[model samples]
Target chain A: MGNSVSEVQTADDVLLELRNLRTWYPTGGGVLGGGREWVKAVDDVSFTIKRGETLGLVGESGCGKTTLGRSILRLEQPQSGQVIFEGEDVLKMPAGRLKQVRRNMQAIFQDPHGSLDPRMKVRDLIAEGLVVQGEMRRDERDARVAELIDVVGLRREHLDRYSHEFSGGQRQRIGIARALALRPKFVLADEPVSALDLSVQSQVLNLLKDLQSEFGLTYLFIAHDLSVVEYISDRVGVMYLGRIVELASAEALYDDPRMPYTQALLSAIPGNERASGRARIILQGDVPSPINPPSGCPFRTRCWLAQDVCSELVPPLREVKPDHFAACHFADAI
Target chain B: MADGGATGGAMLLEVQDLHTHFHTRAGVVKAVDGISFDVPAGGSLGIVGESGSGKTVTSLSIMRLIEPPGFVASGRILFRGRDMVGLSEREIRGIRGNQICLVFQDPMTALNPVYTVGTQVAEALLAHQDLDRKAVRERVVELFRLVGIPAPERRFDEYPHKLSGGMRQRVTIAMALANEPQLLILDEPTTALDVTIQAQILDLVRELRHRVNTAVLLITHDIGVVTELCEQVVVMYGGRIMERGSVAQVTADPKHPYTQGLLASMPTRAVRGQRLAAIGGAVPNPLRMPAGCPFRPRCGQAMNVCVTDPGLRNPGDGRSVACWLY
Candidate 1:
């Protein structure tokens, strides 16, 4: 967690910091009503992932979890805000310097099938990252590839195999191996296990956890599945319509959710343990369109406890309890 | 036709010792290997499994939808005392979408891009029933309304591509329920949809179940979806039923290691900062399935007994398990 740059002073403490992050896609075209209409994919979101800790980003699909992950890695440029990595603003860094920064910050995608190039062998795919960075010699790169292959529980023989030859779980392992090739300090695992089987998902998840401990890695684990997020995350952030509604320790968010949206999301999870005597707070409608999102509280349209005031004014995320920040007008009441 | 006449309390659809295999260039891949289960009248049975687990193949085999290179090799599918195996294509078609309807995953593919949602649903209704054009149109609007599609009349004119993912799925469900079929087969109907849309569709299914008393053979990988809708649960792996019982019995007191592992691996109801308990190894290649229990290679509690093929056997309390451990 040592700071590589002076600008990133709190080097040993925080691995990544996002301030007022906003990612917008332009919509509409030409003529009389021609104006740059933004989709507001990730709107005014802020969070910090500390060194060696996994920050779980939980939200429904299209709520900007993927967009946020990509933005943090600078895979997609943000319209505004700063992505401070190791105290250095990644958004402000030049291309050559950004390329250097990427060696320390890597990403694992949702679909293993789509992420990996089918034509490349597993060994070549893993070595691509190391080769691009030009950090190690060819022989060293090959050794690093083999070591990563073993670390992610893939056989040495699998190096010659293509992505199609392996199963979903095996392919995901290859993806992880490629990500860890450079020995990154921070990784953005975006729905890494979502496409995998329930039984196989656990294996990949456990593997990630073990690897994190071994390498002293920090993660911004983004996923829609709350249970998986809860299991892997030290701190949890619940997002809705491109804004974080609640941010707290995993236990606190699950045990005592202050936001109605958080409570509803938790209640939606089935099974006897959670379902027993717990009156599910079924939200009324679908998430509001990001194109023309709600004025104040984004979740007001679906929030059960939403009132006139909730619609009238947006609630600021304030720390109501120790390490628990909630964005709700009636956070205290909840 | 072993059982010529239907008994009063006979199961609505009884699939016994079913085997579906695909003849690939390499070899014959056993997709559904001697799997057996029953869906009672108006009861909901969930077939839970991951990809290549044979859950989808089981439902397709029942519907006689096996494509070229894939065929039902062995076993009987008794539907209302009739042996569906070796039935003529015409005879099967008479029963298909009439007595039993199938709502497949990806509504976009299941529906016709050329025609309106109403026309497709009307075709399903007209296929079995003797109805005039006006009567069919009336029924189409009614079906759309029943499935909770807003503004039925306006939506009926719109093509499949024009409708949203949720609306297109609603049209599929509407088509499935057009004839008020006794049995409905839904193969991961909501898997492609978002979570919020999934919740809506599940609610719609529950409502329809009560309204039509239609027995459902739901095939899905989501345990959460099964828990929310099903009464009986069948856990599948390597084209076989690893475990089957009442949802409460199977989920709460799982016996088979595969079933136990699946339950443990689910991310739902997990504490923060805990590592998910994942089952080791990948799903065995179907072309090269192990000689003994197909799950043995990945089974966390694999024993010497697992070397021998473990047939699905009754494990008391009306539960069935295909593991030597039980």
Candidate 2:
């Protein structure tokens, strides 16, 4: 796995490919219906996920990582660019074809309490997708739901209970089972374990890892916690204000971060054994508003190594080393 | 100051066998059951637990903020040779926000939405001290500066909606520090902010310790936060203190099985691509706690002796554990 970075993966190995995708929302038009200002939630982001691999997306709040995930799923319509899934462009597909294509892709949300319905029983919640697809019969759906619950470490007796009856960890398990009810090949998990307890978080993470292997799943795992991202991700991408600032193998990114933003983020994580002996790089100020980002680099205002060029010109995500990309003007120098 | 047990320094706040319970329709909820610890003068102590582990309730018990249906059943909360278990409402009010201040987790809810940030902080000062209007404004600005809010003069007039999350948290901290309380209680202060913002807040706390001689009682679920800011720690489970020791001793070599499980389950401590040593079961329900040891239901090292409560036993090295294995 360490040497696979340099090897050219075959075209068929690519499960999902995002190309210059942009998702923006109009801001402050005030009922006139013509707003010049736009909140650039996801701006010209491009990435690819290989088959049976996990790609982690990490950023602070309002960095557009969640928007990027929603855009790929077409839950939020993108203004431009492509989301190629299984050699087909998802953005250009017709509604009928897109509906058919979506059966292979699914999502797991962050909040267990908010994501699951209070009125619905565990059985109905897990079988909601199967019922909507209208292909599987009642008995078959029941069998599939039972199997999924067992796979996710739940008992059959739990089917009659409502979501409120279950604990947070158990509710999250039900959420995972529902996501896997259709047996998706690609899953996008957005902060799945952030709301869970420390012990239960590990349980859910281990469950996700086991399920990924048991069913050859490719995942685009998005989270704000850097340690959790580093633990579960094969490759990692760091986002700052709707742009990918750094992308590399998880090991390489943690070991040798070229971008100052990534360096500060890694150092910001407390109780990191590797960082305990070194001086922490504490970035100043809060994240800038996404509605009107800084002119050149989004992170230049808070960057310790920012120079005149950093504020004068936009930096592109370029290869800093073999298979390591960073969007900093001084990436090579770093 | 007792001058006994783990805390040897000049004691600031010492909690002895605290039992805070809530009377519900179904049954009594033991939110904090028999927990004990101390905070030294100018020292920091972190109380860590999951959602139902009673960490928040303990802080509320200390502040005497437990409302109806919830009450501090039995405990000796000693603050500087004064027992605070049965104080009158008016008497406790004097000490609540004046001598000991609290910083909540969500800054948005902590600050009033209608009031300007400056007015809200000024209200905190006006409630306790008898300062003049201009003097109150000056003190508010100084408090904001102390908490690291940028351009305090300009930000003073802005409402809570205008400031960012980090800045809002700074406002809450400034409000907490307005009277220069002898003891500060921070309940998950950085949990709502982003990582960079959390780092900034922790640094502010560290810097404030040097200027003001205030002891800190930090309540959080994150072990990392505890390790970074605290000298001593108390690990809670089912409202019980499972272990109590210095952060160095506990994180480096945890004594209790529950503590070991928690430390091992942390992602920062785990190696990549391997299965995490996850503690299997969920936290026990507050109302339907286990018969003997609160954690025995999920503990891997539970013995027959665990059927009876081991209570808190002192092992060597100035640490305490409540497990049969000890």
Candidate 3:
């Protein structure tokens, strides 16, 4: 089975691809003749996730990481762009076809407590996805639920318990179990471990890693914490405002960050051991409003090396090193 | 005074064997079980833990802010050599904001909605000091400037909602420091703010601690904040103190498995590619806490002796840990 999985992995690689993706919501009031203002939640994000590889999407709050993940899954329709999943453009797919696409792509939300239904028992919650897809009978669903409970390291007795009855870590496990119910080829874990405690976060992260290997799954892990991203990701994309500034292999990005924003973020994370680099690149000012982001480079407002060229021309995501892409004029200097 | 001796800098607050419990409908939740720590004059201490770790309860107990059904069941709260536990409600009120002030997590809720930010700051000052209207206004503007609030005069008339989240937090800090209290308790002050704003607030706290010579009791979950500002750190879990030591000693050489797991789980510059080493199992319910060690169920190196509830014992050093492994 493992050999077959490895063979399938090589053949059916590149599970999900997004190009020029933009998601914007119209704010209610505007000064210009009642014309609505658009909050550019996600603008021109492009990335791909290959089968069995974890692509971490990292940024601060309101940097559009969550929006990008949602748009890729079509949970929130993109304003414009291409989301090609399994060689099919998901945006162009009809509602009927989109339903089938959902079976392949699932999402685990940030708040486990809020995501799960309060009234439903743990068993029903885990099996709801299967029931919705009409893929199994009641007896089979119950058996699958029991199996999933064990898989997620939850007790079988917890099946009857409500969401509130469990702790934060347990609730997150239930969330993971539910996402895995459909045997999704790709999972969008949007800050899955952010709300859990530090100790519990590690446990959930290990579980996700194990599940990915077992299912040969691809993941788009979105989070704000750089350390977590560095730990779990095979490759990483650093987002600022509404655009990705750096994308590289996890080790490469952490070892040699090209973008100033990425450098600041990396510096912000405390070192595990006493011995580490102490020179922090403290970015000036807060992230500008995405509604009216700074012209050219989105990060130029907070960047230390902002010059006329940076404000005049937006740097493209060009490869500075082998397979490492950075969108900054001074990428070479970094 | 310069050598960090016991003279002059007396103990500002000494909490001995404190126990705070919540009488919920389900059962009596022992939120803060027999925990003891202290905040000396001009010293900053950080209490770090995940949700339901009783870190917040410990602070609330000291402030005498726990509402009905939740009360401090045991322990002595000694503030400036006075027993705070037996103080009357009015007497506690006098000491609450005048000598000891608390800054809450959510700045939006901490400040009243209807009142202007300046008015709130004025009210705090008015509670302790007797000043005329003009003098109060002058003090409020001065505080706004002191906390780095831009356009102090214009901001003085603006309501809480009018200010930005960071600015509102500054207003809260200004209010907390209005009376120049000897001790300031900040409960996750920057947890809800942005990272940049969090950095600013942390810097502000550090600066204020130096300027006022006020001891700080900072309760937060973020370990980075602890390392940045705190001199000493107390690691709590399931309503008990898991470990307590100087930040350097605790972060560098964590004695408790829980503390090590926390440090490990935190994504830092080191741990690369490997999945974060998360401690398995959830924090045990405070209502039905496991006998012996409260953290034994979720502990990575749990042994038979761990089941015999270990108390905080000095391991031949100044550091204290409540783990059998130690």
Candidate whose lDDT is highest: 2
Model 3: CA > 4 A from native = A1-12, A29-34, A137-139, A270-275, B1-9, B300-307, B324-326
Order the candidates by TM-score, highest first. 2, 1, 3
- Taking chain B only, the TM-score of every model is 0.96, 0.96, 0.97
Question: Between prediction 1 and prediction 3, which has the larger TM-score?
Answer: 1
Model 1 regions more than 4 Å off:
A1-12, A31-33, A272-276, B1-8, B268-275, B300-305
DockQ of all candidate complexes: 0.58, 0.78, 0.55
Q: What is the interface RMSD, in angstroms, for predicted model 2?
A: 1.2
What are the per-residue Cα lDDT tens digits for candidate 1 across A208-265?
9999999999999998887788888889999988898899998899889999888877
**Model 3 in CAPRI terms: which quality?**
medium
Q: Write the per-residue lDDT of candidate 2 for residues A1-334, one digit (tens) a residue.
A: 1232212233788999888999999888767777568999998898889999999999999999999999999999999988988877788777877777788899999998998999999999999999988899899999999999999999999999999999889999999999999999999999999999999999999999999999999999999999999999999999999999999999899889999999888888877633456468788898888999998989999998889998899899999899899999999998
Highest TM-score against the true fold, candidate: 2
Instruction: Give Cα distance to truth, residue A303, candidate 1, Å.
Output: 2.5
| Displacement of the residue A112 alpha carbon in candidate 1, Å | 1.8
